[model samples]
Target: MEITMYDTLLQLPLFQGLCKNDFTNIIGKVKLHFRKYNADDIIVEQGAPCTQLIFLLNGEITSQATDNQHSYSLFETFGSPFVIEPYSLFGMQTNYTATYKARTNINIVTIDKLFVLNELNNYEIFRLNYLNILSNRAQVAYEKLWNSHIGNTEEKILNFLVLRSMKPEGKKILKIKMEDLASLIDETRINVSKVLNDLQEQGLVQLSRKAISIPALEKLTEKNK
Candidate 1:
């Protein structure tokens, strides 16, 4: 059977910035498919073994989980080529903690897990690249988990603002809903609203209908610390 390559794969952040020839070579070994799903369609469920390294070509993925008290939505819409779980490729036996669903029509390219491992193991560059990506993802996950549990409400809010700043175009206005902030900090919407109100009163964050923007981010972080 002949495998077809795709240009869209190069557009994803994971493959973006890679040399065109390098991406093309990788695509040559991949199997391309367009997966269409409606909102709430399960893309990958918890406890299911990861068979392929799914490169999300388009649309959004939401990961959610429920604890004893309430269900927490970890992500509302994370973008493409985000690995659902990297350890799946390493033969780890742990079950998935969260369920992944499509927030809209989703397009994906799935490469054979075995094929990628075999090729990457033999190629030093590919091995380094793969490890680097996994390490970065792990760190992000760790930070999210750690911040949600230990920090005070003020500290949590400050940390979120600083984190956004670390990304590209960090100075741009962040218009996030109260619910997203609450979810990120593991607080209830009501609690988040109260915190936001206090921050507004103290001139830490500015609040408006449908948006909460942080103006003096550095000062807020220092105050929290």
Candidate 2:
């Protein structure tokens, strides 16, 4: 494998904390499914079966999540060293929650879900990491669910971003209309615009004609706290 490939593999959470030998052995034992895409190419569609664990090895990708019934949608951009919907691989859904598109020329590396269950689970560190990832997602989701109805407009907006994201710490770009956003959070359009402007003044977000960009989600979360 190329050094770049090795570095990329190690960057993913599932492969972190594994010793060098284990990493090499695991790679040698499996055939990595690799693909490349041009900007604007569709990587996967929403509701498609997530039969493998896909790693964004290079470049950037944008994902769109539409509400059930196609009422509204949320779009987010994620860079490399990322995984696409790991939690969806084995759950009752077993399908991608969003449609992902290439935002730049990108490389993808995937591991079959069967290999994940039958092979990757053999490594104790890998198992623990997977458990931690899934458990964190579930616990955060449960807590968020309980608080879904009680936050103020600002809190509701922040929770909207957090609950819809793939991870809580990355720089994320969200594409949605002002009115659509307000409807999703159960606030009026005027209220949503006011809170968004306040957030922009606080330097927590940048508003554009087409989208809202968050430089660092962690900062927004901390400021809210």
Candidate 3:
């Protein structure tokens, strides 16, 4: 079945609870600019000024952040029609928190920040949705900060696995290199290798050159608990 833009909007968390009428009103009020990107294209650089809300209409992208040591950590990978850091559009910094690069040929829709602000003020539902989105982002940020401070290597590894998995059942494949994983966790390659070996021996993960697969995600979650 073919999906319309309205259908795509409905799939997004930011547009949840908005009816067809709301979407129609939004389309009438806001102009959407469409663009395409090839694999490895940089959509936005970290710390770059951001004045538009970007939506991934199709294909894959990864967001990465650089630390004080200039090491890059994979933040998140996103698929179609999802907003890229909506909260950043409003804050005083008005800068992208991470660099977004196309992981595949991609389609994008962008709306100016002024249009977003106008909609937020004119529509009660849009205002509430925007606020809720910001709140959720803040909560996730808090959890990441808290987790960084408290966990041991093993615990942190398990927590990171759970987060990357995005669920507690079915197989989960991590498309990352061991070296990058080490950089992500700020650990040495040898240490990260040892930890992965321990997890493999315990039957929580299966390692291969291309990916790490968790056959039973629950087993990894059990370690986190």
**CA lDDT of each prediction against the hidden true structure:** 0.61, 0.86, 0.73
**TM-score of each prediction:** 0.59, 0.85, 0.73
Off-target runs (Cα >4 Å) in candidate 3 are: 1-3, 68-70, 158-193, 200-222
Compose the digit string of candidate 3's lDDT tens values, residues 1-225.
134867886677667778888778788878879899999999999999889988887898877665445333434566776788787887688898778999899988888988877774577766787899888767766665667624666776666655533223556566577887777777778887898889899998888874676677777766677
Ranking by lDDT: 2, 3, 1
Question: lDDT of model 1 at residue 78?
Answer: 61
Worst 10 residues of 3 by lDDT: 66-75
Judging by lDDT against the true structure, name the best candidate.
Answer: 2
Ranking the candidates on TM-score from highest down gives: 2, 3, 1
Error of 2 at 12 (Å): 1.7
lDDT of 1 by residue, 1-225 (tens): 122234565555445456666766665664555567777788877767777667676777766543323322223346665556655666457456556888777866666677776653555556666778778866875675565456777777666654433221112234566786688677788877888899889976677775666664566756765
Better of 2 and 3 by lDDT: 2
- Going through the candidates in order, what is the number of backbone clashes in each? 0, 0, 1
- Roughly what TM-score does model 1 have, to 2 decimal places? 0.59
